[model samples]
Target: MLLTKVVALSLSFASVWAAPSPPPQSSEVLEVENAFTASKTAPKFKSLKASAAIEVYWHVVSKNSSVAGGNILDSQIAAQITILNEAYSTTGLSFSLAGVDRVVNATWFNKVTDGTREQTEMKRALRKGGAYDLNVYSSGFVEDPRRLLGYATWPWDYAANPQNDGVVIHSGTVPGGDNAPYNLGHTLTHEAGHWVGLLHTFQGGCNGAGDQVADTPPEARPAFGCEVGRDTCTADRLPDPVHNFMDYSDDSCMTEFTAGQAARLTAAIATYRTQ
Candidate 1:
């Protein structure tokens, strides 16, 4: 069953991932597939009836160029930790970002000269760290799906071998300005959704099948302009909630999880055991 599902899924995404350009070009939702589908060998945690008390060790790997001043890195780390808590709180999941606990040692100290190259190297190094089962390595690859978070790779934490369960938020997406929601919790939430086994509600394209999860409404594509109530899949009364955490909505407008989504996500997490 898993093999057939994977094969069918691969064919479904063959065109999207193969494209050199970013996804959602024409209401087409370009997203990571096989993110939730895990192999039997991987650890699966029984569903937590409620929020499970877990300590998440966070190691922020930053480049010298990124930290213009000493405080910038501190501020960014603080901000990210807060957001992660917010998402967890929403779902009754609890975690703490252990400061500088396990830094995935990297050779590159200078600014990421090449966004693509930096992300690639970062993933490789993360895979080496056996600390956490998953690592969210956010640096320069947030905009492009080809880079994983930015055209890089899936499960950003390669070191842990957690597969496509990790994520990255590009440095360019510091929470602020007009696209804060699209920036801050966007990638993390999306990737975290993958961590919990949720797929892009719109599936691969805006018009057709993407994620198999039911409660999540289908989106025409990744909506960034903050068009609330925009429905790509009209089969139902409520248009696809593109702005929902599962959908690609702008920063501020994106909020709330459907009851169905909440239930599914909670169930998915129950299937995985801590690394």
Candidate 2:
């Protein structure tokens, strides 16, 4: 079961916005969220939920003068916080940068993935705080750079993996950085959605519950570039959610999240993470 899921993850876009680079394999076997810690399987979230203001603490692991690997600028971290807040501005939820800490370690800088003992140990040593605050770990890479941009734990996972309950991101994906197409910082937005219990808009393909949000159209698969009118589910009246933040379109292409999504995400946060 793990192999089947992880292999499919290799094919899906990997990250919060999980639009990993195209693979030689087929899209049918695909996944969006990367395995950033001990989680190798996709999580299923069904109930519609809503949100509240969230405080975020930034835990930056780098190889600078500190104790891990390379470092990111304070300015860069602030900018990402700004972008994150902007993404949730309309959802009745707000994200503020509560604090910032940097640890210098080369081993952690280069590699961390889902299902790895190293990842678990790393998170255990570095993770701080509880469900009341969002813990974000920024590094140079996660799992396979060619396939994953980042991965985050769902709201409920915090209970089982409190130390691992946060989003792991590729440092290059920050805004104003060089990670093109995904450089705008929406990756955090996408991951934040998952952190609040959102599934990919294309999850379960063109059929079934279709991401469990009534407003979001069922997408057959992750859309690559932004094609405005692309429709993969001809049998369904709703077009593919190519532009949703949950889809794998380019950062520039991602525009909105449905009202239903906002409600469900809010509810999830409330259910899992108490104030």
Highest TM-score scorer: 2
Q: Tally clashing residue pairs in candidate 1.
A: 27
For 1-275, candidate 1 gives per-residue lDDT tens digits of 01111122222211112112233322222222234444213222233434345444343554443342111255655676677667655566555554442343334322332234654565555543332344555443223444323222222223244433334444444454122334564455554555455555555544445555566666655555467777766666667665566555555665666666665555554434433
Q: Could you tell me which 10 consecutive residues in candidate 2 have the lowest summed lDDT? A: 1-10
Q: What lDDT tens digits, residue by residue, belong to model 2 across residues 203-227?
A: 6666666566788887777787797
Q: Give the least accurate 10-residue stretch of model 1, judged by summed lDDT.
A: 1-10
Error of 1 at 102 (Å): 9.5
What local lDDT score does residue 181 receive in model 2, on the 0 to 100 scale? 76
lDDT of each: 0.44, 0.65
Any idea what lDDT model 2 has? 0.65
The estimated TM-scores of all candidates read 0.63, 0.80
* RMSD value for candidate 1: 7.3
What's the CA error at residue 176 for candidate 2, in Å? Answer: 1.4
